[model samples]
Target: MRLRNKPWAKDKLDQYPQYVISGPELLKGKWNGVFDKVQPIHIEIGTGRGRFVTEMAKANPEINYLGIEVQQSVIVTALDRLIEAELPNIKLLNVNAGDVTEFFEKGEVERIYLNFSDPWPKSRHAKRRLTYKTFLKQYEEILINQGEIHFKTDNQGLFEYSLKSFSEYGLLLQYVSLDLHNSNFEGNIMTEYEEKFSKKGHRIFRSEVKYR
Candidate 1:
């Protein structure tokens, strides 16, 4: 998807300071206090349009949600959606997922969600894939013991490669589903991309992996 540069995106986000943490001091090791509760923090990387994280916050009010999107224009749509929803348990971050540990403290996050992330199908670009071992190792620094990575994608090649990547990094895999919508998995939330792809008769793959 081609991203339109929204010149006013940052200004729009500034209007919702309560939902978007700006300063570095406000974030570092203080994420729990931002929500004014010590609930489990769950972050969704590459939260395009914010459908999945927004719905997850609505469905699980006890869990706090933070969405990270590197694209300013993409995050604007999500921030707008979140503002309209009036969800207090969710926040948005317009930054790279690779810089997660910079904002969050070690063991600060309980779960991470990677929904329909970029496939980066080219073998040469494997390191850029969200499920790559390098990224997983970074996640391990901030995630609590046994914290899980819940992943869903329509690309079979990425899914297969991710399985190997997670295993190679010593993650215990569970809830593996070749076709998520056709399976018995409960509490499945549909992302914007997931809905679009599934409507086109594409199979959605899902799995859960935790650091071993």
Candidate 2:
């Protein structure tokens, strides 16, 4: 679902700096000040439309959740929904995932979520994949030793590639699921994409990757 250019998206986000950090660089290593307390940070990289992250924040009040999305149009919808919820532990970042380190300090994030991310199926575009080794290294820099990545996708090819990428990077795989819906996994949160694909009978793949 490609979004049209919403010229007002940026301004809309600007209206709420507390919920949406417009200039994330200024708050580098100072994210704790935003929430006024030190808490485990969990971010969903590519949080499309904000369904999963918002629900997670509502369900888990103790952990701070950040939803990072490059598209302002997409995030605009999320901001509207989050503001209505008035959640204190959730914030949205209108920044690219590649520059994630510039916003959070090392060992600052406890969990990273990659839900229904772009597969970047082209052979030449492998580097753009979020689970690519390069991106994994970037995540490694911010995630604590015990931190883990929770990833799910409707694309089997991407799932296989991510599994191999994680293994090659010396990360341990836990709770790997080939059919998430039938696996009866506890605490499973469905993204908008996940629900759409699953209803069409697409098998949802999921995995948890952590430092070895």
Candidate 3:
């Protein structure tokens, strides 16, 4: 779950995220200005190296995209991608996923993407997973009703765990795919991990969960 220790992220991560908001203060009952009037926003948590987020932003100019990555090196790469692509619609933030609610006002996010999030494979580490009950609640407060979460990964255990987590939270799961490339879903945006795993002969897993 820690990207700080990675060599690639160590030398290049930007400590101060541009186009960043600090925390939930923006969305609390007493807040004003910031997130209240922005266009529809979509968030990508753990956007490594910015491949997918950059492409998504390039492809979808009407909607704003925010990508957060804890690894400074990765986020630097993300910034580079944005800069090179000349994508004005995308923003990069270097931060952990745990403080999602702290960063935005309530009902500010329209959708969320948990692309290849860390599995946190150990049982005791369940709380660290992004789809944990607590994180889901955070998402609920920030996401509009029927706000959706789009997740994709090559990890089976994590996918199964997330599936259960989504169900327990009463979020409806649709477009579940145990094998992504095998599925008929079109326009699948593949992240760095997705490309790596897909080439390894591993079947990618994907699912869409919507809050009622």
Better of 1 and 3 by TM-score: 1
Query: Candidate 2's C-alpha lDDT?
Result: 0.90
* Candidate 3 local Cα displacement, residue 77, angstroms: 0.6
True lDDT of residue 145, candidate 3: 73
Per-residue accuracy of model 2 over 1-212 as CA lDDT, tens digit each: 76789898888989988788878888778777788557889999998789999999989999999999999989999998898899999999988878678887888899999999899999999999999988998899888886899999999999999999999999998879999999978988889999999999999999998975
User: What is candidate 1's lDDT per residue for 27-90, written digit by digit as tens?
Assistant: 7788888896789999999998899999999999999999988887888999888879999899
Candidate 2's C-alpha runs over 4 A off are none
Candidate 3 deviant stretches above 4 angstroms: 1-38
TM-score of 1: 0.97
